[model samples]
Target: MGDYDEDTAFLGQTGPYFWTTFFLLNTVYLSTGFNGLYMVFIGSAPTHHCLIPDVNLTREWKNAIIPVTIVDGVEVQTQCSRYKLDVVRNLSAQGFIPGRDVNLTNLELEKCLDGWSYSKEIYQSNIVTEWDLVCDDQWKVPFASSTLFVGYLFGSLISGQLSDRFGRKKVVFISLAAQCVSVLLQSFSHSWKMFCVMFLFVGASQISMYISAFVLGTELLSKTMRVLFTTLGAFLFYCIGYMTLPWIAYGIREWRTLLAVLSSTSVVYIPLWWLIPESPRWLITQGRVEEAEAIVRDAARKNKVEAPPVIFKESELHSLTPSRKYSMLDVLKNKNIRCITLMCLLLWMAINIGYFGLSLNTSNLSGDPFMNCFLSATTEVPAYVVSTWLLKKYPRRALLSIFLSLGGGLLLLIQFIPDTLQYVALALEMTGKFGFTMCFSIVYIYTAEIYPTVLRNVGIGMCSSAARIGSITAPYVIYLGTYNKVLPYILMGSLTIASSVVNFFLPETLNRDLPETVEQMQECQGLCHGFRKTKYVEDEGRRNQPIQREAKV
Candidate 1:
């Protein structure tokens, strides 16, 4: 087959049409960023204590009804236990003061049978406060967050095959519509179980839209712009969305309103369907040459450049006519492809574990929840900026490993910071966030480059599915902080460092032509050696060039 890049060369890079498509598709990341981490606020557990009826008791008796326990060397009101109502009533009826008349600690203590009173200092309403997911029901909070990633796992698996078979543009819009409906439905849920059910769909649709748009950009943009588009353009918009979420939550201080407001933003993106065209490269793969040619011709016209009379040459038409279908299983059957897929799975998983773990744990940090989340989201701006610059100059393999190690190392150091120096710990955590953000941006470009056009979506989907496994586990990992705050950091750090070491086994793809078919994939030469690019060699002596293979190892 003819080189796809060469055939589309007439369209050129950075034209009016290209810029329109680029910006429109990347705008979807804004919604993705908002939805992905909104759970941080939606499930935030505000300070709370057991409720005490004040009908017959004095103000001091009312205060004394809630039991106090020492936590972290300081006395605090217990959330799950309170003094017995009968005993407190009798004491109050006798007009006895709490501290002066008797020792309150010696009184009978009971479970918070009357329910809990949540502090309204930070949040007016959230799933945690609304459903009372505290003490005995606290497990539901992490489980609810996990349900979204569970949906993400399933969505990744489904969207990949659908995008490959139907088309990228189709899946993008369908997922966006699904995301809007699911999130809107989620805000109205009366029970935690119902919220979780809708959350699953929200997770599924959001990631599906994100992955489809990302893969679409990879196919549509030229090599010169791909790194910037993937790293800075898309993620910076997402960072803006993420950074804005905390402020919205700050103003609203209620989960449902924040969610409804975020979900409604999707309606504005429905019109993007007309602005963005289907990938011509994908059309060519599906043997729809005329349709692909028409799109390119229109692009050339909008680019204000004359198109070549013949877009797809005779040989290009003849070679690409026999279409072959591929599946995720095909990726596993090949040794070279399987190795790359395995490494990608682990790499994406490790990145997600670090990324989501830090993001979800932001509320637990020593600061206002809104400010902590905003800082976490804001860290990505410089991360993506630096990642974009590094990606252009360094080899993908080395840069990815360095970023991963930097994240893991910073996370490990957080455990050493004294509790009194909380700002120092937070600075270390933000630096870790920066490291993971950079790695997250680079890995997308690296993975897209590793797979061939036919298997690209499926390959990325498989890796993303693995990433969901990490995302699904992230909440539980953060939950480990309840037992011991340092445990999560230790686990995340060790896994990240191991994944950094594993990244070296994968081959580099800097300045390389994207592999069009499985046969053209670059082979990783073991530890001591580098990569060997596989391509068809045209005969210099013959009038008619035939496709013959040669490998330079």
Candidate 2:
């Protein structure tokens, strides 16, 4: 056999087996979309103000107790503070009327000591209402969101090694089960701290399931199908899941009810363990030749094709070498690889921060939060379609830089837009999200192609870990917007632009052969070094020559 690609060519490329794998894996992809972004709804802060408990006051007096404060240069009722309730009650008992009979503006104000009341028009209950995560405790809202990414950070570090040691299928199911259970637990959380703790597990399991399923699908599909799955298939399913969140939240206004609905979706995947097969490619790497052959045979039978007598050559059927245990340190060992790693880390972090920063802040944008979320998720569908087509025509680095620049440029423009034209601001933000979505999709394919095969997992893991850092910080970025409306946009825009510049220094990997070793990777050139020549053309020719000779025999 030539390589894993040629060996798998025996199975039909787009028949029963291929389509079966596509639908099964897409199910997991869909689940990830919901689990990943449910926080945007669950942790949302609806319109709220300090609660005025029953102090035997009239309706007019109750309404007048909460003080109006200037937020973002607009006068709005303060969510955290109120005119001292006791003072207000005493004044009301003395026949003091608010606004007309008394100068209420001069009354002493204090933080909401009792609790807060939330508007039930949109969200009946969210974390903001459940735990009083507003005012002095407003910081807790974003911190609760950040806890999930902290779990993501830990998951990215450990899941890959676990999958490699155990198996992709095992890790995938375990993570899925963990995610479902954790989400269920999160719905019943008695306190903010408890919810955050459970969300950590939900975050960890969500990412782990996503990564394992991604690798498993990549290993099982054909090359063309693999590109399609990553660029269009899985990503589109994720978009579909994301788009569903707003409607789900719209129907189930309570955060607990929403979590229950989302967590229950995973139960559908439990039966998929029997339908989806393990990666035969991973099996070969573990020297389980018989197991690998058996899986391929089953695939052939399912595809209605004849199986080859043997799936691997003797040389290919060996356990992974000690060198395969490459660590993250190996990425930094070489100057060229180190440079590329740092650049990728920067790009990944910026893309994630911008993407999630916009996603999480959808509620704050003008227009209905549900509609804004629907529109944001809908924008990615076209973006993925456009990106899928562009991936075939353009070089990876150039496209990445161009998209990053576009995304950053749009975000930068948002800071200068007049707030009076809120629609204009919303349009610009959506456009920016489109650009970032394209970059997000492209970078995954680009990073994989750039790294050598041996260190690919490690490199990707490091990049994902960096992305978690961005995600953890993204909520805080949104929090900054509360201080100054344009600050979050400025920070995300600036960082994305900087990363776009860094993209120019990273190598292009359009038609180049995947480097099997680090030395081969070092010789590759970036946009600064023109374009690297393809090493695979002559290898394909040589491999074809052997087949030609065999035909003559």
Candidate 3:
């Protein structure tokens, strides 16, 4: 809706950029999730001793571990899945003969529970507190995870609404302040409850950040560039931040210190008032015409051009008017919108669950996590390149469907591979990651197209929140011991396949004016009608060029 202007390209100054950078990188909260937990194999568990009697032969034999025993003349040692080992109480409970085989009983387990058995229950681990990373209290880890997700869930729902209700810049300020306070307080937390309370606030704060960033970036760009800046720039940067998180955590080595460093970076946002301009579109929508005019005037002055006689007519700038008013009930009433919503939600859930679930599997993959994580992320760059090329040439629906199918197929194939060929499996997994990342990029563009402008933000928010639901589930799937390791991958792959099937029902968005009203959405009819207009435009442009050139000659 807006013309090219200097304000469209940059975030007025570097301060806002710094703020954006810091917020984007603050994923250290998510980064630390399973990183510390995965350290169980290499770290020590809290221990207690259990005495074995009437079996001494040598000093080494006397010191034999209580939880281990010779079964049928074969020695078998087992421990709980490194992350869940904290629940083991007594050595005899694990398999050891405390005094003799006849003396063991579950009712008298306290003998092993005390502090000397040095043997944890089989496959049970409490890696969250192995060595006090910050030496703080031990039980706050899972609470922190829940609090952050709660914050994210709250933010995900409310941020878009806030940006629409207030101006995007104002909401940006709000999110920044709230997140900063939460991060700052979380750092100072002396107990689990304090951390939880602070994280709830922090999660709410991120809503402002996402909404503000999207709005401000799209403010002055053309309709096409709006897609570029919002879809490509912001989304890509965020992914880059996600990809780099593991490396940063590895470098820092302590989760608490990493979180503290991320929080302190917020102070850099204080200067954003001078760096980023308020969103002009939001200004018009909020009835701040004068302020909106001034922002445009400032842009013209910086470009050494005169401001327009009028900044832009109110009628042309933005309109959310549809032929009929849309209530939440209306979304369900409309078959197309309902179909689009449910499909998008399912797609979102699957993507988040699979993406992060697999990410946490870096620990399960043999060899160094640092290398494995980095190598997987490295594939995303080429993914973006390929996506950019294919999207321009083919329908997004087709390309996305294909990518989804490919990702699912690769994941399923992973199960057939022998354990020794795991690096090959990892490579296949990266290919799947590439496929999903491309899908991730396309959905933002596609889902935004399915709704009229009036409900676009709400639609996007709801769809993304579904993905957040998947994000919440992902950690549990990988680490909760609820399902097997390959299960999340299979689900992600299957969901993508389902999405590809569903995509066929949705209309393609190409060479069509954005439907600003319900009437336009209804009248657009099909892709053929829209492409016909594009053909007409090309014909007109070609017709004018030769006459103009001959006249010049």
Q: How are the candidates ranked when ordered by lDDT, highest leading?
A: 1, 2, 3
lDDT of each: 0.87, 0.85, 0.57
Tens-place lDDT digits, model 2, residues 318-359: 324554478877766666677788888999999999999999
Model 3 whole-model lDDT (C-alpha atoms): 0.57
The most accurate candidate by TM-score is 2
Which should have the higher lDDT, number 1 or number 3? Answer: 1
Put down candidate 1 lDDT per residue, 315-411, tens digits, no spaces.
7556655457788889878877888888889999999999999999999999898999999998999998888888778999999999899999999
| Candidate with better TM-score, 2 vs 3 | 2
Task: Give the worst 10-residue stretch by lDDT in candidate 3.
Answer: 544-553
Q: Residues 86-112, candidate 3, lDDT per residue (tens digit)?
A: 222333345544346433223222232
- Clash counts per candidate, in order, are 0, 0, 21
Alpha-carbon error at 281 in model 3, in Å?
2.3
Query: What's each prediction's TM-score?
Result: 0.89, 0.91, 0.72
Ten-residue segment with the worst summed lDDT in candidate 1?
A: 527-536
Q: Alpha carbon lDDT of residue 456, candidate 1?
A: 87
Off by over 4 Å in 3: 1-63, 66-77, 80-127, 130-147, 192-197, 312-325, 480-483, 519-553
